[model samples]
Target chain A: MATAAYRDIAIHLGVDAGSELPAQLGYAAALAAGCEAHLCGLFNRPCLPMIRHYIPPEVIERHKAECERAAVKARQLFDAAAQAEGIATEWYDMPGSALETVLVQARASDLLLLSGVVPGDKTARDYDRETLADEVVLALGRPILLLPGAPKPGLPKTILIGWNGSREAARAVHDAMPLLQRATQVTILCVDPEGQRGLPGAELARHLSRQDVAAELLVHAGRDRDAGSILLQTAQDRKADLLVMGAYGHGRIRETVLGGATAYMLGKMELPVLFSH
Target chain B: MSYRDIVVHLTLDPRNAARIQLAIGMARRFGARVSGLYTVPPPNVPYYMGEYIPTELIQKQMDEAQTASVSAHTEFMATCASAGIEHRWLSSELAPVEALRLTVRASDIAIVGQPDPNPADPASVPYGTDVLPHELALQAGRPVLAVPHSGSVTEIGRRILVAWNGKREATRALHDAMPLLRSAESVHLVTVGPERKGRTLLAEITEHMQRHGLRLETAIVDPAGQKVGMALMAEAQARQADMVVMGAFGHSRLREMVFGGVTETILSSMSLPVLLSN
Candidate 1:
């Protein structure tokens, strides 16, 4: 619960003037609302490249004007959402890659809100929706809440932690603790866990007790089913609202495969998954 | 970090109460508003068979759906009222999965019970989706907390087994699980390897855990020609790790295929809870 309290939150607003902009803005508003936080809408205006010697000034100026117009529009949108939510808000219009912009801005921010980059949809500052997660998460060194392309406004209530027993998973749980503690219910779901070391659920339950985050372990003897599918299946079966799990649990190459859990879940997740990797 | 709106997909299953109670507890914890959503299916009558169904049978189908809807709403309201959480109720004539999917908004998280594939005591309007959670997680664009059909869930994030890979996902999973580890009764960190740069990697992780104050000892398992996933499961079983934290495989498409085999192996053969982050 203290996660968003008294912090600087940055939201990435891309320039493509597409649908993703609102979702990012909306989520930022929701996160900053009533949290006593400064919500900055970091708008990546697609201005002309700094190489003015190669291009004519008139053309560059035209692009600059267009980009600035978009930035104004984006700021207006962000301001409206923030005002509606009664949160303190600011806007920054910068020209450059959205990914690079976020990486720089997030260094001073406690949290970053980003919209899922839709493949082929031209976003502001040439933001690549598909690769944003990997590029930003790896370099930002901050927590980024990725909103599904069309996100609805609300914090996750019930949560499913994809407990795979990886250092990555551990980090996710650590960063997500504040949010996990605030949830009404959380589940530790294991799909065909490689539990040669211990009984899977018992120890985790005891550990959660210390945090007052009562949790139960559910093991799926996955038979001819992928872990990602089973995880989402079990989550839906339980009617969970949120998924908390570590990202990239397998060899890096597997993520390229469609059957891989990380790839599958990221591409086809029906829920708001808080992935940290 | 607080849940403002929480939605529960109410089914006609008997275990609905358990899921509801869990959601109620979550709402109370974060001071969130609860929304009870139910998707009542039409009766599987002679209509699907393309047979001339009797009027009485058709009437019965409608009646059954109505009754199930009313009952689910009542229960949801009662639970929210008792828990003293703000609440709302929404239902649709659509398929159960579809209803739950539409209910998901960026700011809202949904709680739904898995469709009972084989309901020992099926409700008047029975439904099942062994794949609902998966579908929802993909389509809802929100987080869906899935409780098992058989277990009674109270909380999560305790007694965790962290599968360390010294990779991006592994590092992410560890940090994500930090809050849980900080409050855990015990924490176990394990790395499966064949001694390739082992000592340095192990030491690095050890130092990281020490910095974070995680007390569990780390186990570097030598697969001994066994698959890394198998080795991890064996270690998890021995440790009774209720939860396993590891990174999901989403690095390179080519590597995805090669790595998919191992991650796929764990996904298919898991025997305990594993937290996968990507």
Candidate 2:
């Protein structure tokens, strides 16, 4: 078996006064150390909308000062974390919308890491966490690891892959190969609808085996609406530290309406979830 | 990740030998097994005349198909045995399109032939089989390597040219070709489009590939009024790339068929082997 390594990893840093910046940097640094890769931290300093007529000058100055302060804090945290982990690191203090800045910077790395978004979490931009993850996954064409609020600084030991036999799922699996290869146990969880044809996850099992990844398959008959909860429960039961899945959406790229399972997972992600679109 | 199982679609065309040889070489490189799939289009009879067909005629058609499959199989076996590679032989009774769809499930990558529009030997590639490559690439859920009908491919994955447009399909093709690109001597990432601002995606990709230890020579080519596909092929030729790795189609098949897309142009007029994943 040829073990693959991710030599370049990027992390999305939300330049806010006080947030989960340290924890996010800590987890990302740990991963970069494990893979011996260069870690690039992208700090998004939100720029105010160019509507001077509507906004007052003092308000704009206040916002700019706040952004500058947060950017400094973010860089300090990132440098300290990377130094502690003793990994190669780079930092970019970009001035723009959080989503656009992160998307552009993320294209230069194999894997991306970010603290899971939540409502009222004081992120740099005024976008929801789910929206941030979805936009980057769909537009950037890279695998993103959404870390929980305060994740332990290390890689996953037991990984769970949500398989549905779609193109998105396949892409997620391949993108997560580096993590999968390093894990001690891997399980392919297939939640099939009432009466679908030929074993849902049997082919994926064989496919992974061919790549020298021996995976255990667990299938359950359930409705599509319950897939998200079922996968979460399975990961918890198996003690999986990482959840790998496809980010599904339909319609226009920008205005994508996520599928049920994808939406549910994004809203209620527990462990570190690696999502690829 | 490396391919563990490879399937080569075998037709009666003498070029079948080239496809098999390429597969064998790849199998040797990856330490994998090869499966030769032999399929022919159903006897060309009108669908409305289904039940009225005579038994002898059907029998005769079936026999000819069997004979073609047998000869192809014999050659496949001989080639693999001489190469001393682990291999399998499969002949499907199902429709060519359907058979390939099912067979590709067990394989990581599929090797198919570019349909010869004006085949010198009609028996080699019948009229209906020209669509198999496109069909398999789109529907197989696996990467397809389409070998040109007239190329003598002495080397594959040596000097490679990748068409990058920052689309979903292009991303898939790039990652799918990683295993091959890892061993290639040179890789050129060419983007065919007009100059535009905020296109830092290419620079980011360059940094990404550098992390993978692949030094990519990137170029931005303006189509300058030429078709995107034509410009891409011209770039490939100018670079003297032995193989072209690209995303199959950015547009839907129906839309591409009607409006003419890059995938169609490349499929219709490829001078070298191309690897595509939709």
Candidate 3:
């Protein structure tokens, strides 16, 4: 998911321009330095109703020029960022609806970085970025990094992981490998430890040890403590800057029946979280 | 934080009155406000030759029903006032999904009921039928505490299971659950794997927990020839864990269900309530 944020949506779409570009570039650079970064840029020609309608030729020309200008500026910013990041970059420009373009790109990208659409933006006529982001999360079935303002400065030093033995957690670990490798200290806290095994915990510690990361594993065994509350406490105790984990584990069915830790954490945690599904 | 200002979402089903009363008692314990929500299907429209008939009267009736619904809801809220719990009524024109999203955003936590049995197949049962909790978890980005529709709210969180893995997700979950852990009676750290690396990870986890002033015990499961999920389930059941907290396990959408080993296993097999953080 982080990869897509840096490569496709942020870099290619040039949504990182203005205040957001520098931090986005920095994150991309950090990633490239640590791992093999895949850079994908998406170009979407929005099927604007105004453009599709049989309007006067003059009006069509005017709208075309405006869009072209925006495109050119975005291109310049992206090129500069990509050049500085020193990563291989690819661009996908398709003629379709904006939503389709995003979905297609998101399907391929690791992380999706989306620029929130202002409710009353004059330039974009119909698209609602927030709703679109949510839809993309549901449709493309990937995690999304919604950059409300500029990206947070610096790579995360302290990372709080909401661990459950679910596949989402495993995917989150893989997704966070690059960052975890660079973090100063990684803490793995088990909220309900009454019967948790020591082997898997040791394996994870061993993995981090090989990566040369200073890691700690902690178990919080308590009765009646839900996973979400335990995770929040651990994050607070460690002063973690970023939390990384999987997205929703159970679907509509499992969630409705058993409840989900991810849902609880999202609602409670205030820190920045990197989620991958 | 003080437990005052609780927001409860109650179903309007008459049979659920007992459940509503139980929820109100919980709210009173926390000194919170209660909100009753009823989810109804959007009014239907008849189709004409090409376009749907615009039934103005039907629209008016729908509007009036909504108003009456809110009024009835307000009466329920008044009951809260008598009990010293603040209350309010809310009606939305949006669908249940959107309305629930809005409710989660507006409140701290949402309380919802469990699903009912399917009428067509009486033997078949439903679990969490309301989409609100999961949607709120995913989209509203809030923590939701779900109560059984029939049971009473007991002491919140007594025996918690931290599905420990040395993964980023597990670590985050542990941290997220610290507040409750500090007050827990006993915490048992369980790891399912070989003992070699397990010892070191156990030491690290033990040290971390010690700092938090939580007494910890460690358990190691070999899983041997069995899959990780089966082993974990056996261990959890053996311990009689009320809740199992673990990191969500999956990848891309398609690969998540088909290729994912641990997630599929847990989703299909878990007998106990599992807390999954993705």
Fnat for every candidate: 0.05, 0.38, 0.00
Q: What is the TM-score (0 to 1) of candidate 3?
A: 0.39
- Give each prediction's DockQ, rounded to 2 decimals: 0.05, 0.37, 0.02
lDDT of 1 by residue, A1-277 (tens): 3442324667777656565666657766876663446787788865455574598878878888777788888888888888888887666677777776666555445566766644444546333554666567654545566665555565567788876554345445545655666677888876654555355545445445444566778876663247666677777778776677655523331243125555445534435656654
Off by over 4 Å in 1: A1-6, A34-36, A47-53, A118-127, A193-197, A223-225, A249-270, B1-278
lDDT of 1: 0.61
Instruction: Give the per-residue lDDT of model 1 (tens digit) for B121-221.
Output: 44433554444554554344344555555566666545778877655445545654554576677887788875453334565455445544567677888
Over the stretch B97-185, how does candidate 2's per-residue lDDT look in tens digits? 67776667546788988888576655556534688777777666578899998869866998999988765566668877888898999
Between candidates 1 and 2, name the one with more favorable TM-score: 2
Better of 2 and 3 by lDDT: 2
lDDT, model 2: 0.77
Ranking by lDDT: 2, 1, 3
Question: Evaluated with DockQ, which candidate comes out highest?
Answer: 2
Better of 2 and 3 by TM-score: 2
Evaluated at residue B20, the lDDT of candidate 1 is 82
* Candidate 2 Cα outliers beyond 4 Å, as residue runs: A15-18, A50-54, A118-127, A193-196, A251-269, B11-14, B38-40, B47-56, B89-107, B118-142, B197-202, B222-224, B252-260
Question: Per model, how many backbone clashes are there?
Answer: 158, 0, 76
Is model 3 an incorrect, acceptable, medium or high docking prediction? incorrect
Tell me the docking grade of candidate 2. acceptable
lDDT of 3 by residue, A49-165 (tens): 654456787876876676677666666665666677666666565556666766544443445555432222334522354445545544544455544334344567888766554
Q: Residue B59 CA error for candidate 2 (Å)? A: 4.0
| Model 1: residue B57 alpha-carbon error in angstroms | 85
lDDT of each: 0.61, 0.77, 0.52
